[model samples]
Target: MLQTQSNKSSFFVKRPILFVIVVEVLLLIIVTVGGAIATIKELDYIAAIWVSFTPIALILVIYLTWKRKWGSLGFQSLSTITKQNWLYHLPLILVLITISLKGFEDLSVSKVIQFVSFTLLVGFVEETVYRGLILKAMLNVGVKAAVITSSLLFAVTHALNMISGQDLANTVVQIVYSLLIGVVLALLMVRGSNIYPLILFHFLHNLIQFLGPEATGVTYFDVIALVILVIYSIVLIKSLNKKTIKGSIAA
Candidate 1:
């Protein structure tokens, strides 16, 4: 187990981009297969299968952290949101506003618990992989490269939606929105922020996003989110400099 862990961990440290590609491809496959399986399986059975994924992800994180001897993945604690970096949270606020506008479906206790658990799982896993692992890996190239590459890869992750059921046009827009919003999340790591709050952000946003089964997400929020993120990204890009690459490598 130790040797296997070392070998796997070295693969990520030695070839970060390749590791990222493999991880993304695996994610795509898992989601695709899992989605397909859900249709053919009972709800409780499918839920059990999906919930099992969280522990597997956790084990991977623990193994890698141990093998690499990483002191942190920016997830140990939450940092206070100060005036300096407070603006970076606007996208999350926008998500709240958008969800409010679109509103939510009636919820039972079981459904609310399900949404919380599901979104929390997503938030923890995705943030650790993208912002924590990928961002730290890419920093060796350059700060700009790290930010753009991590964010772009993360954004492209949403493209898998098209394969499942979404239309092409909507998928394209999702990719764009995800790309821009991804940059903000990546920048939080660069700014020496903790991953816990970022995970919480994901939790809240995705809870509304994946609310009830009948939820239609194509509200006016999409257009407004796109515009705001585009302009916000431009300003952030301008702000990147030698000072921006502050976080230590995940290794």
Candidate 2:
């Protein structure tokens, strides 16, 4: 009887996290379906903005609920900026510069407008759903599980773009690359507990991809860079774990 009571207590303790996860997933589904219908009706801009802002709205909703239930807002516990954080963002800047230079030749006013509108809308919406709510739930469950699962979820969501004439091969590549980006973002999320930095990087990444022309194939340099970063990040995460464990034990 005592064991069963303990199990129930544990479940109840985790219910808030689970509730947030369910709400976020449901909202994403509704937004996606509604956006699809709007796109079909040629209301692409409107749909895009709606989908993008939904996540941000949900984040605010969650914050309010959490603040009421707990004493403080959830965002208060997020990671603060550090020297290492700035250094970590350097690679992302390099990637952005390269992408911009490559796309400069074909840039036009109409494409720029479309790209900015869609990219901002999608980035805010998707990151809030996937990284904010989904990630929060996963991290509440287990750190390693959260990192892997969120990354996969983020990657698979990219597959939905295929409905709009994106080639299968290109879609596959984008998904793979997105998974890597997700892994990096997940690392940042786990480190900082804040969503702002991840959101900024994600927005820039999408903006470049949307505005840039002919991002069809992964270059040899990109492949090499991906391999190096994946290996290095894995090692770094492991080292971080060891340090955290040591610190906890000492305390």
Candidate 3:
């Protein structure tokens, strides 16, 4: 009798969790196939389009789920998390400034344009996938558990990317950096209840990193600075929780 009861409890806990995992796996598979095809065809632009389309598809899925009134399926609580705070944008700006300064020496008009495009593509794709879809789906499991689970998953995702082409030390270091940023993004989503701030910071982060001529070795230091920024944002949020999400939501 006790064993049966325990099994039932486990089933309940695992059910919703499995749904999100399945969705993520599906997405990864799709992207992998697209990437392979792009490689075979030697079409970098096709690959870029394929990569950029994933987030757009995910956002549409989320919107459709919400419209259909499907309960907690694939980022369904968009309405619940639209609240905003002006203070949230402050950290975003500071983070952007710091990152931009590092990359400024290599700045040129063409580089700026490329950086802008990269920022929008990567920022939107990742924010939608990581914070928006993953977090919302995990929330269906439980709030606290969602945050911790998604944070770890976000960090681990970076590890796979790092292993593909990046150095071993950088990959390990990125795992740590990814977790810190993951926590910050998750917390911002919860506290600000909006996606814009996270999106902005993500865009700026990538823009700075990719635009610069700085060597890959120096990126370790950049990660260190990023971690500090995350810590500072947390402290600031704690001190004035009310101001953290003041004017962020769209009508």
Tens digits of per-residue lDDT for model 2 on 69-152? 211111333245456655665666665665565554377888788677667666666666566656655654566766787788
Residue range 117-142, candidate 1, lDDT tens digits: 87778877788778877776676566
Using all chains and alpha carbons, the TM-scores for the candidates as numbered come to 0.80, 0.71, 0.70
Model 2: colliding residue pairs:
79-192
| Greater-TM-score candidate between 1 and 2 | 1
Worst 10 residues of 3 by lDDT: 242-251
Displacement of the residue 34 alpha carbon in candidate 1, Å: 3.7
Q: Tell me the deviation in Å of residue 3 in model 3.
A: 35
| Cα deviation of 137, candidate 1, in Å | 0.7
Which order, best to worst by lDDT?
A: 1, 3, 2
Can you give the lDDT of residue 16 in candidate 2?
41
Which prediction has the highest TM-score against the true structure? Answer: 1
C-alpha local distance difference test of each model: 0.67, 0.60, 0.61
Off by over 4 Å in 2: 1-13, 16-24, 45-79, 105-114, 214-232, 242-251
Order the candidates by TM-score, highest first: 1, 2, 3
* Prediction RMSDs, each to the true structure: 4.6, 6.0, 7.7
